[model samples]
Target chain A: MPNRNRLHGEEGRAYWSMVLPAFSIYLLVMAFPIVLSIVLSVSNYSGGKMFGGEPWGFAGLKSYARVFSDPLFWNALKNNFYIVLLSVFGQLPLGFIFAYIIYRRLVKWPGFWQGVLYVPNIISVIVVGLLWQTIFSPNGPIAEVMNDLARAGFQSRLEALFASVGGFNVDDGLVSKILDMAGPAALDWFSDPVPELKELILSYEGAPLSELIGDLCNLFVPRWSPEFLSKPNIAMLPVLFVILWMYTGMYLILFLANMQKIDSQVIEAARIDGASEGQVMRYVILPALSGTIVNSAILAISGSLSSFSLIFAMTGGGPSRVTEILSIYMYNNAFLGRPNLPLANAISLVMVVISFILIGLTKMAEKRYGGKEE
Target chain B: MSDEIKTTALGRIGGAAAKAAAYAMMLLFTAMTLYPIFWLIMNSFKSTREFQVSQLAFPKEPTLSNYVEAWKMGDFGLLFPNSLIYTIGATVGIVFVSLLAGFAFAKIASRATKPIYNGFVIGILITAQSLMIPLFLEVNLLGIYNTRFAVLLVYIGTGLPIGVYLATEYIKAIPSALIESARIDGASFWRIFAKIIVPMSMPVAVTLSILNISNIWNEFALINILVSRTELKSLPLGIYKFSGSLSTDYGKQFAALTIGMVPMLLFYIVFRKQITRGVAAGAVKG
Candidate 1:
């Protein structure tokens, strides 16, 4: 018995020795930082200084208040939710469809298609962002194509107007109101710093705001509709489009892997039961893929919530602070907000809470669905 | 019999239609994914003047000068090595440390196993967004701020939970007989792990390494927040130089982005199997 106890003790010691490094690293990098963030969020930690200065006085709930009132923060959250909605509604179904097509041998080159589809996932996000920017830049190929397609009379007229007044700042309330009256497309009808735009904006000699608005909105706005990342709602469409493009392939690969796990005989049996292909998909395939679909949804939700690099690279959260997601918002506060580290910390804490809530909600949905399916 | 024959004909027609749709989707998705990348490479060869004049047209006279210019702008010759040091060093650390800990949790029947393993599991769910401010503070506190070591340490830390979890799950599948028999032969724990566990757990250790490498290689956020010095910049940050307000070098920007991308793209192409497996394995175990 004593020998056995000694052996057990030795085993315990060995286990501790092995586990110690991992636990220590996790504590330092993950746990400690999280605790520090929570503490800093509540404290009077001003600027980026968390240490080596005057002790920060405790400020209760003020940072939270700042996050609540910030319109940009709300906008960022709404944009993030938009991406989430797209991921769930747009990317997942499309991914699953691709998987079903490939895995079911409806296509001959399954492996080739798989490889081709996944190419986007490997490219650096900065590169991807640059690629799209190249495609849609002010003088990019798309805009040039659109320019060719547009009416020549309208283009020359807009150019002359822009040259006469210089480029207009739509930020002026009166100009914006007037542009709205003319129609959305009239707002940015045609402009990219050529002799025309440079002459227009730079040459402006303070004419009545209405004439500028009328000339700009009624003529130019509609012309630059494909100028992605130009306005908030418009910018979101492209950003969301890219998000869908990049991730659908990943989820497709995932769904394919999961589909491979389901026995072929089960699918064959459904087919033999006089089930149409659609019926087979609805009954057998959907149920089998549900777990993976749920898992993918979880990943998508968490991923969408934390999306930063791609959007940041593409838009820098701008063309008017429209593309700022929660992660980018927090980054701006922490790193770029200049001495606003406390508010950044608060924003990060809010981000974490939201992540947990969303993840929990998905798991609950899965549970409810799983129970019904069973 | 006549009704059955009619239904069969309809079924065949429907199947053919579905197959055609599948072919169309496959072509569309591939084009959607690859076309932009192809365009980036194509335009990298064009001069900015040529790009402006005929952006869609193939370059009449392709130039390597854009690459030379982009290389200088990004200082990528310096940044590539920095990225290598972080990714390789972190990959080694993650695989090694995870092997040790995962081995303990999987092989040892001790009371500490459940809680210690659970600790790593909890570690996986902590998002980097939440950790940004405090992690910045903590790295500074550790006095490793702005150094490559700071990035490396954080990479290993973030990579460990998933690494250990995967290794643990993979190791759990190995029958106790091999490990127990090794123990009964009076082998030391280190020898057993190094020889028996390491070789037997080869596939998973590999998966972990690849995943870690890809992650550390492509990582932008942590390094972006952590490092400020131009020389210490990783490959992803190299593209930022082309984005200045006065950035007029469009040809060079595309070329620089291509330079930044090509190495990773080559790695992915060469090890497509390993990478695909690595990603799927990680996702499955998650």
Candidate 2:
């Protein structure tokens, strides 16, 4: 202890030698960038070598002002907010529920289920995002399903009309009537169903009630458009869905691992005391895991705010930046297009500020509720 | 008493129904998670004609032509090795450096130790997005931007905080008596670290390796920013580029995705237990 407490000479050098390599890289990679970003946020450094062609000048608040003023920036911020809300409210609760179910042995083969559930988390986010992207694409699974439904609806309606007319004759009036019934929103998509109808007329069987129901339901649902991916309002939904799919497993394991540490006797005692399953979860498990829940909320908020790769891979902030979260917005600004490095830095700084504020709020709430639970 | 019996009977029925619902929910989620990858794999083996006919259909006549085409077009031959080099290089680098630092931090007593340790932990809070722009500048300043070395350096750097945090906590749990005995043998610090501490910390090193390997393997954003060259880029970047350029070719795109994920999936299958356990252990500890 005496020898270890105070080192000198070669021993002191050894201590530093071990620590410096990792610490220095950390500074260069993480710490220095943070400071440099703050500085760059104020300066109008476009791109290329810093201060290369044009001298760097301070544009105090200009970059931030531009970001705040930009509608796309706000859209990106709003999307990021959706992601944060999804991660905190959607993924965490779902993950916690899954973890609880497995913990309580509510599902058979808990290990198998746990392993299967966690599969998405271990795969590359880009792969998951791309897989989902393809699934949502025009020729992908969703389009196929929707297209089938669209076809079925046309056939069923045509059949009903033909039965009313007492014939399978090719009537332009019947076709026009059906098209009118489909409404304007479906018009563009419903275009050119006549040839398909002619083909189906020769071999069409009577539609089942279930198929008719499905066809009816498809009318109310947003028609799957090939341009949906490029449409501003609808584009972010797929990215958000993929994010939920990809991350829930991490929190599941986090909760399950922490839950396992809660002595079995505690849960058993709760049950013995006539606490129903819901009561045990609400009273014992929830309060006991409140700390981990708060920690996970902090993780989710920061992670959501900073998430980049999946969105980058899936949407790349296209469709006029509707799907752009702050990270993607920052990346697109800094690296892509005109390369507004200062604006990117400004966006990043805003991200940092937002993360801190959210995390601080999470901590504050945790303290308040956690104190009450005690 | 009769009323109580009736309520208990209702409670039992409710509980059974709830259990059934939970099972159904788990099954649904499992399908949601696995079906896409399964569909991708199934579609990858189909002919372009067959895929266009029905994306949902099992490959009518399974073929490897798409795989061959994707392998050549996606530049997997180059990018696969590049990804391996970065993942392995960063993972090994993280393990060695963090082990050394963790040992020092745990065993040594110095005024500098606490602050240095805290600095690494503080790094856990700094998200990679905020650092991306400035790190791009820093990499350029260092003249290593668009190079594999930049990717390696940043990967190791971003990885260190969690690595060091986990290692320090794990190493601290190792008994001091072993270090004391080694010191009494007049062992130099290097010898002690190499001979005693390194051997003793194999568990944490394995966990560290697992965590870093998986993370670095999947990482894209940092590498995307750091290196623009196709040859220098990793699997995720390669797959991303392919998805955009090969958007029309469903077979080729699925083939490329399968290639991108297969190695990691294989790695997961081989080391499933350790990977899951190691991940849980790492997260819980951190």
Candidate 3:
């Protein structure tokens, strides 16, 4: 028998031929760069020939210091944190509930539900980002709906004011009285009281309050501005919602597949025992899915840490860099105007460290709270 | 007996309520997921002026003008082919390399197998963002920057870790006795692989292709960093530029988006089963 441990001729050649193609590429692209990234993060190489003699020195944590000191980095990190929370807290639970619904056959056409829900995930992240960006833009559907509602509220308020005033044509004195009560915005509409008035009323949807009655009526209208993409404070809100929307489908499918592996007979036996549906979910299904849930959390945390494409396409980290995540920050640093390679490398290393720490915490949490491992 | 009857009645009511809640949740989420895409397609058929007049209203005159204009202005004619080339090239490379390596790791008893396999597996966590800087330098050093070859190399390289890991796990299940018998018959390793392993590994090969196709097709960061030439830009980059240069024309923007989206959606519909199973398997196993 040929010695299996030590391949002599053909066997060794075959192994080398098969392994070298992938291994060399991995080493060249991933493994080598990862190590190089760590080293370059500490070096003072800002740009220019990387290995050639062009202003290369040991920066020694300077890049990291710069990253920490930049308030933009903090904002970016904060945005990523919100996304992580959304993924774990928002998407996972919603996905779980959706999966459970489908798994238990609680809804009709479960396959249709499953297929439709997962559609967003399979589409390109950039496309989904652009689609949501349009939906939240000033001229988009949400804005249209909000504008319509505000206009409707304004029309009703105008009707009430006219009813109280006895008529629309009540001389200049009555118009002044109406202006005093409804604020200055009422002046334009009260003057024409015709085709132009409709446009005038729509334009004054967020008109300032002048008196108690205006304030009371304005509370019902609640001025709707759909300029979210440019607003620094809340730009990430739409991004977060989109993240929740695009990714929940993936986790749903993941959970559904894991749930399918659980024998239906076990669930049947539980049901036959006098356990209610809730009880079955708690005792049998939840316990069975604890491992999958933990795994999904790890995926979520890691994914959250590295979120780029969607946000990059959606906001391009705009509105004074409010929507930037670490990845985008790192990307802009590396590729955008005046590349800062060292700082970009440092940011990436920081991302790696954070991902590991978060993933490690998840695994630890799983060990503690997750019922006996399957 | 009366209490038992009352409890049963309560249980029945609770079950019905739960079912109703389930249906509501499903309907609400599905609508949220689909409505935007539907809205996008509907508006893509309208002129920019019509869209501005009533954003939510159905197009009074659905025209193909937006689509024709977008197709011309976005240069989707060029970008679509570029995307396909990179996606297919990288996916094919990953699968071929992974299958070969997986067979070696599984059937061949080597001291180098464990460490090499472990090395590839570590790449599962090494995201593209982390490696972007060094890879840019490496691609430049290799003298293939701004070339499709560079993009393919990076995609196949970055995608290898998971591909190799999945391939190895799948191939390990195939009986070694088959390979041993083939070897005893004086058949060459390549011959045996061609005859036995290649056919046996089809399921994994399909899964690897699907996973990589979707990933590399939609990949933006690498293509953005590696390729600067306009001719080489993929659909994502094309659409991104369109979003900027044509920001005012919502009709063309929607049409560009529709052009980018429809092919993949069609692919999903056709391969609905394999794609989902492939995606679920890829995620769970990886």
Q: Write the per-residue lDDT of candidate 1 for residues A245-277, one digit (tens) a residue.
A: 888888888888888888888877767667787
lDDT of 1 at B14: 82
Candidate number with the higher DockQ (1 or 3)? 3
| Candidate 1 chain B worst ten-residue window by lDDT | B1-10
In model 3, which residue pairs have backbone atoms overlapping below 3 Å? none
Per-model tally of clashing residue pairs: 15, 0, 0
Top of the candidates by TM-score: 3
**DockQ result, candidate 2:** 0.57
Candidate 3 local lDDT, B62-85, one digit each (tens): 999999998888788899999999
State the lDDT of candidate 2 residue by residue for A45-100, as single tens digits.
87766756668888898998999999988898788789878988899999999999
List where candidate 3 sits over 4 angstroms from the true fold: A1-5, A51-55, A157-184, A187-224, A355-374, B1-7
Ranking by lDDT: 3, 2, 1
On the 0 to 100 scale, the lDDT of residue B58 in model 3 is 88
**Interface CA RMSD, all predictions:** 3.7, 3.2, 3.1
Write candidate 1's Cα lDDT for B184-264 as tens digits: 898777788888989999999889988888778878877887888988889998886676552457889889888978888
Q: Is the docking of candidate 2 incorrect, acceptable, medium or high quality?
A: medium
Q: Score the docking of each candidate (DockQ).
A: 0.47, 0.57, 0.56
Which of the two candidates, 1 or 3, achieves a greater lDDT against the reference?
3
Point out the higher-scoring one by TM-score: 2 or 3.
Answer: 3
